[model samples]
Target: MSDNLAIRKIIHIDMDAFYASVEQRDNPELKGKPVAVGGSRSRGVVAAASYEARKFGIRSAMPSVTAFRKCPDIIFVKPRFEVYKEVSQIIRNIFFEYTDLVEPLSLDEAYLDVTNNKIGLPSATLIAEEIRKKIFDSTALTCSAGISINKFLAKTASDINKPNGMKLIKPEEAMAFIETLKVKDFFGVGKVTAEKMKRMGIHTGLDLKNKSLGFMTKNFGKSGSFYYNISRGIDDRPVNPNRIRKSVSIENTYDNDLSDISHIETELEKLSESLETRLAKNKIQGKTINIKIKYADFEQVTRSKTSQYWLSKSTDYQPLWKEILLDERLVQKPIRLLGLGLSNLNTEEKENQGLQLTLEF
Candidate 1:
């Protein structure tokens, strides 16, 4: 690797159960109790779970009813997006004080490039600690940070000591650390991929490193090459602050299953309007429309159609939404959730404009 690549300083910061922690911080009564942030426990999914709730095996995205079964006394609180967004800005402001090369993965996590920082700091570890301390001072919430030479290692290292902690993977130690890592811990390698790799006797990073680049590419295509490089502690991808949003989606889970066509249509219109607002807010249009339906029995189905031209109008989705909603198999069952999404996004130079604002540091 070139000296420039080997010397880059990247940091990944992740909040500690952001939503649930905010709820606990604001309401003293909720502290020390298992808290799940979302809608009613009867009809929604857990958006976030506090450390206390996680002790009971509760997790984000688990069905609320299932969570209730796991912890009968688990408290469910509705999400306050407005509040969360405000805090997100606060932390982002703090990040900008150090470097303009900050990339947000979500409201709860972001990556920072501080090789050349505003503070003239030589140690990325100190910058990470100061950021964490400032976040606590500003919001009374703790965050974990990982420091490394690239985004992948920084992200993976951030998880090593989570919930108010920090870890640094120096360039010298990167290889040995990655070598002992399990295949499942590799970024972008999900459950099915890990299982497949295991079947091929690739259970650890060492095992993956043993495979020739040609062998991995032959088996996994483009991603195979990525796996080969990252296994050897080599990742050159930049921390792109101008990353584009690939898709926009919104979904709602109803308290009561909708059995009537009229009710379903009304809900679809509301969802369509919401999707339009989101599209306009992001200043982008999409070439594909996808509709998702989850039945009361929890069986979900999705149908999609692509348009030759990009669309920004909400009404453009009505026809396709109606067609998918009225599918014979779907109409036969009571619907518990309805989702509308747009993909193959078309952006008008906004991402490029973001690039123009970049600083070398």
Candidate 2:
């Protein structure tokens, strides 16, 4: 490692099953029991699953119905965002006391660069321990911490021990630690990319490191270079504290594939309402509306329309959803999923006399 890299101390903090844990903490009866937060037993998706639920293959983003099938006795709890948000703020406040270079990934996870910190702690490991302890002390919740030179290694280390565990990857051990890492375990290497890597005879970080940079770029395009650098444990991405949200959206998968236009319309209405709720909560509106449809065969299509001005009303989006659905060539196909989104974000408000007419073919 270079001198600059050696001196950098990065830490990744992830709360242990945040939503479910919060529910369990607030309700003493739920302790040590399988719990899921968000969605219901009948429809929608699992937002988060407790570690207890994970034993039966339950996970976030899995359909709630599927989660039910996996763990018949699993308890489902509706999300309490107000409570989650408050806990998140408490955690964030703890992080800010350690370093200003805190980049939050979500309500439960964040990256903190402590090369230079407020408390003048020399060891990043100690800083991580202190932060984790402070989080528990403040919220009565546990978090996992990873200490390393960069975000990737720190994040990977955090997962090594989970649910109130901490792990560190020292500079001297970084190379060896990376060598044994499977390609699938690398950040940003999804199932599709892992399959592609396997087909290319790259199975481990060592295999990736052995390939020429040119060979990687030729095969994987922009991501090839990323893979190459990470295999050697070199990631220079900074902890950006000022990331902005460019869009807000909501999506759902039904218990049965929706076939008729009427059913699809009903689903769209629900999706639109959900999207509006999210937008209103975020206090944002957008000029663009996007509709996503997934067929029963897994084929998906997205259609979008950008208005001249930002719109926050569900009334403005409902007609556009109908237009997109009617205009789609695959309208006759059974729809398995529906999604609605808003982009081209605008925070400024314009006085609306009523719904302004703006639609183009």
Candidate 3:
């Protein structure tokens, strides 16, 4: 590996079972036991499961009732999001001390692009170790970090070692490392997609890499291109700061599976209506409509289509249903979750005036 390429240092940090761990950490009595954080409402879902609980078939977003059934002794704690946010900020402060190129995926996970440094550290590995030490010293929390020449491999490396650990993937070793990875270990490949690939005999990263981009694109569309690149441990995307979000979305899990198209469409309509209200609230404009669907079997599919019109107008997303057409295919499988988002961002407007808009993705 060329020493010059080392300048492109990236690190991905993820706190271990964040919500559940937080609960356990604050309440010493709960440590080393099966713990899950969420609510007991009929349709409530688990926000996080402790490592102990996870070993017993529990996981985040699993039905609360199912979680209880899986581990009857599971201690359920309500989520304290405000506290989590505070902790997240403390960790974020630590990242900014090293580099401003931090992209937070959630309260407990982030990608720090340390291509350049504030502390003049020569090795990203040293910075990662120091960050872990600071996080633990300050908040009594442990975070794992993955370091590499690019975002994809860096994120993958972070998971290689867990809970107060770090892993480094040199540029030359990235491709070989990814070649041995399971297809399921890939970022974009979820349960449903992984099963689809498995049935196609694409079990490993090398297997996925062997497929022609055209074939993968035909199957997965735009995400196919992402898969093609990441399969070879290549990710050129920058760690963008203050990126404009052109869309906002919310989703709720249902106690009952939506076997009927009417129910699924009803949920979509509600999500779309809420999204439109959010758009108006933010005074943002976007011309793309996106729908995310999760099947009862836990397979997810996202379909989006852009338009020449902005989201400020009602006519923009009304007809998007006619374009993507995944609803027609989802008729056979019951939907467990559904969400809607708008993108193809335009610059923000502070006032309540609507403008004719055109957005390109």
TM-score of each: 0.93, 0.84, 0.73
* Prediction RMSDs, each to the true structure: 3.2, 9.4, 8.4
Best by TM-score: 1
lDDT of 2 by residue, 1-361 (tens): 4344444688999999999999999999999999999767876678899999999999998877789999999999988989999999999999999888888999999999887789887888898989988999999999999988778999999998997999998877888999999989888889999999999899999999999999999999999999889998888777778666778888877778898888888888988888888888878888889988877766789899888867888997777767777784858788878889998897433322211121110
lDDT of 1 by residue, 9-114 (tens): 8899999999999999999999999999985668888999999999999999888999999999999998998999999999999999999998899999999988
Error of 3 at 287 (Å): 7.1
> Candidate 3 on 1-361: residue-level lDDT in tens?
2232323788899998888877888999999999989846344679999889999999887878788888888888988988889888999999999998887888899988766679978778888888989999988988899988777888878888776688998766877888999999987789999999999899999999999999999998898988888886667677765655656676766767788766776777777777778788888778778777777777888888888876654456767854565547856787777777887768752332112121110
Minimum summed lDDT over a 10-residue window in model 2 is located at 352-361
Clashes of 1: 0
Cα error, residue 207 of model 2, in Å, equals 0.8
Residue 10 accuracy (lDDT) in model 3: 81
Off by over 4 Å in 2: 1-6, 252-288, 294-301, 306-322, 328-337, 344-361
Q: 274 in model 2: Cα distance from truth in Å?
A: 6.1
